[model samples]
Target: MHRTAPRLARILACAAVPVMLVASGCSSDSDGKPKAEKSQKSEKTDKAGSSGGAALATPESEKKPAVAPVKFTKLPEACRSLKPKTIEKLVPSTKAKAGTPGRSTDLLTRGSCSWNGLDDNGVKGSQYRWLDVSFLRFESDAALGTSGKQRAQEAYTKEVAKNRATTGAKNVKAAPSAGVGEEATALSYQLRKTGEDFSYVTIVTRTDNILITLTYNGTGYAGAKPPAVADLLKDAVPAVKETVTSVTAANK
Candidate 1:
């Protein structure tokens, strides 16, 4: 009985060795670090940042974004934007004083009109004239894509350059126009059309997202003198200013 008791005590002590090693947190790593401590450090690093030492990437919803607003909601009528006297002066002896409208799928985005006339005086002489007006509008919508004013500004530059590059143009001149709109450009030149040397003046202006292009040209045939460029410019300024005003009026 005494030998059996002693043997049982030895066996219990040997079994407790493994429990002691586990409680002490023994591991194969040579750094002397407990397995639990190593696991804790690894977990913290996985979190990327937790102690304010480093920050996570910013979320899109929290970042600052670019934005631009567009003014004016619609465009004016292409044919009625100009006054009766203005039309008469631009296109003398007109077939239709109301002007001819262009095809447009969306008036809020674009509109245009044109007029041409020949004033006949038989043996005295014959005078010819032509006029055109176009308006383009844009909207600042994220869904529709891009900024409205930016698009119009690009179009404004393109249109002005195109007019100044007219084929077979003579004495072409360019200058900034004032008191017309937010910004405007005037291009004057001479072109032989309708069997006469016609004076051409194109006024390109913009107000917000809307671009206004006004062209006035006149020529003389059968010994008649073409109209002065200065006179045409003077008349064009008022007519263009009125068109810009009409855009503002349409929105109001």
Candidate 2:
């Protein structure tokens, strides 16, 4: 009977040990959650942290904005047809003057004449002569014309006012004048200087364009026939008109 009791006691002890372990695993803590559940929650938080770390490693190249292409166009006729010799007379040419002839092969008709020049300061100058009369189909857009005129007038007035303030010229005056009867606007002013070298400025606005002409000569030549320098500009006007016409037609 003693040997049987010893064996039975050993088996009962083994069963109790397994039961205690199972109860401990299933029991709730002070927070009323099982230990196994807490371990699973910790594992889920670690996974989320790992995912956040991976996201932070993204490269900067993916966050950049796309760039747009550059747009360039030909110069307007009023600005383009300026003669080099006339310009040289107006603004004395320096040793560093640079000039190159160019053409607009893009024109529908091939009678276009063009040139490019540079000043001592490396500033570029250009001229274009278009003889094709068919190039006038591209009249200035109505909206663009109005806006351009307004902006040009404002700038001219401001520039004149600033010049007067800086130079303190006596009897400084400016008013709008008719510009060749082309629905154009002009601002003219007479400037007084010592030794009778009178200076006059004419700012002409035509079809969304502006031309600034400055004349300086002694009284002997002021009222006489227009200075030979002035004729250079007059001669270029037809060429400019033709070139502008060609360019406009090509664009259309």
Candidate 3:
């Protein structure tokens, strides 16, 4: 009986050892759950912040331009650009000597002015004259692969082509002008308009981004003669230069 009792007690002690081990493992799992969950949440937050920071690192809207900024911003007043001597010689009998300004929404981009007059000689001859000037400013555009000067050059060629394409024009001639701005072209032709033969002198010039255009035209009234092309071109050079100078003056 004594031997049986000792063996049973030993069996009971071994059974209690397994139960205590199971309890200890359950307590470890319970203590680790909150820490594991907290670690997972921290990892997720870190990943989300990393992704958001990457998106803000680079901005697509900041594009660099290929060229420098243009020098001239505003253009000179077209009509007022011409010198007084030029206006006087071009339109001697101008009714409004102050000159009339052309229409434009933005003077910085473009502007123009003109004058016209008639010197009436009863029973002899009458002379009629007209003069006008125009100015245009160009800006650099990197997208188009053109600087301010290049854009102005294209416009210069276009303006010359436009003058050459004049319909019903007679004796149309285009020649490069010297000693005026960076480059210039003189277009002279004879066009009959309003029952009168008129001589046209157009000068398209460019200095930097600014384009200058000077036009001088005249007709004879009551048995008069047309103005000579040579004389008109000689007088037109300085007038165009004066207009160009006005641009530099404004910039200064």
Candidate 4:
């Protein structure tokens, strides 16, 4: 009977081992489940954070607005921007009847023409005159965020400033010129060169996206009287007006 009691007690101990193992396994599973859930939650949070950041990114519609299109696409011919009679009056006895075309790599955006003449009066000094006209066309740039007219205006302002600061220029004067273009400024000055005083006139005009610069200068050689500022302006104003008209005609 004592041997039976010992065997029964061994059987109970073996059964208790299985029960303890089951309890330990269940506890492990419970702890592992919570850890796994936490890991899954962390992964979901990371994914959600990434998705939210992408949603908050800038869109195309909110970018800078594009600039407006230019009014003039091309420039007028510099040599043909004025009438022959006008040219004759401005520069008498011109060396080149057709005017000399200024060198330019791109004629569509930029061009210039110049004329110079010396009218000789046998015993009296000769009258020397030089005329130059240039055209610059600007285009709207979306990347630069600038409109063609705005760019032209900036250039126009700079041109006026430059003319006002001409080297060796004296008695410089600038005034608003009416009946010329969208905006016009007449700059006149005196400069001495080649042992003679010369009168100069620069008519800077802006029409839409185009800028027109006209410069006229004259001097008397061998004791002839130099041209008067009033006379120079009278000729420059009409010549510049004609050039402006040519711009409209060319675009048409």
RMSD for each of the candidates: 4.5, 13.1, 5.9, 4.1
Q: Total clashing residue pairs per candidate? A: 0, 2, 0, 0
TM per prediction: 0.78, 0.30, 0.75, 0.84
Candidate 4 per-residue lDDT, tens place, 1-252, comes to: 999999999999999999998876765555556556678888999999999999998887567678899988877889999899999999999999689999999988899999999999877989999999999999998777899999999999999999999999999999999999999999999999988899999999999999999999999988899999989999999999999999889888
> What ranges in model 3 sit over 4 Å off?
1-64, 142-145
lDDT of model 4 at residue 40?
82
- Over all chains combined, what TM-score does candidate 1 have? 0.78
Please provide, for model 3 over 1-252, each residue's C-alpha lDDT reduced to its tens digit, 9 standing for 90 to 100.
Answer: 999999999999999999998876665555566566768888999999999999878654345447767989878667678777778887887878779999999888888999999888877788888888988889998776578888998999899999999999999999999888899999999999999899999999999998888998888888888888888888888888899899988888
Model 4 worst lDDT window (10 residues): 27-36
lDDT of 2 by residue, 89-197 (tens): 4434323223222354543222222222222322332221111111111222343333333543454455445545535244444454444312322222333455433
TM-score ranking, high to low: 4, 1, 3, 2
Best by TM-score: 4
Q: Which lDDT values do the candidates have, in the order given?
A: 0.87, 0.39, 0.86, 0.93
- Candidate 1 runs further than 4 Å off: 1-27, 31-37, 40-55, 61-64, 141-147
